[model samples]
Target: MLVAQSSDVSTDLGVYLPLVVMFVVAAAFAVGSALLGPLVGPSRYNRAKLSAYECGIEPSPQPVVGGGRVPVAYYLTAMLFILFDIEMVFLYPFAVSADVLGLFGLVEIFLFIATVGFAYAYVWRRGGLDWN
Candidate 1:
């Protein structure tokens, strides 16, 4: 019987030096921009600029009875936008690799599109797309 001895292996910390440096640089740049923005940016402040922006609507000086509640339409529209946006995000990868993915991928993508289409139809029926 022959006994084999394994040599001690040391982990190299230098491999991660670039990553650490990059993170530090990014953090420094963000902090520097935030700190410099207030100083370098324009300080011209008027009533309009100081007022709370509600889309393009003019802000009332007096507060509303219920703390000025925003309309549900704003939120619904935002959610619908996100839903479709995520669908597009999923679609890009599938489109890029469609040939490699073959029939199974094609079927899966169609199912996904169908599901999204159903949701779109439901929203349309519910008047979610209506501006007013």
Candidate 2:
């Protein structure tokens, strides 16, 4: 017959008391600032502050117009850049662990690239690359 011996393992709740106290203090300070700001801060509004003034000179009385709508091409170009950039980001970690990941990693990466390649082809066919 073989006998196995086990050592005693006990966790002390007092070890975590300091962390709990710090969290409570931080939360109280944050809540106090949020509640105090509106009551103590400025409540009055003045015309001078409300109207736009150009450096020490009186502002010209002109109608303010909203900024023009952004071009769809700009958004499309940005999205394309972000999408390809993210693909490269995923490629890095896989490359670093390639030996350990082996054939499974290779197959998964090939599938990922094929999917992204299809998306790239779709973007190309839709005239997303044209700058005009």
- Highest lDDT, which number? 1
Candidate lDDT scores, in order, read 0.91, 0.87
Error of 1 at 27 (Å): 2.3
What is the C-alpha lDDT profile of model 2 across 1-132, one tens digit per residue?
955434322245566889999999999999999999999999898997798765565666664476335678989999999999999999999989999999999999999999999999999999999998
Off by over 4 Å in 2: 1-64
Q: Which candidate leads in TM-score?
A: 1
Error of 2 at 97 (Å): 0.9
Give the Cα error of residue 124 in candidate 1, in Å: 1.7
Model 2, position 39, has a per-residue lDDT of 98
Q: How does model 1 fare in lDDT? A: 0.91
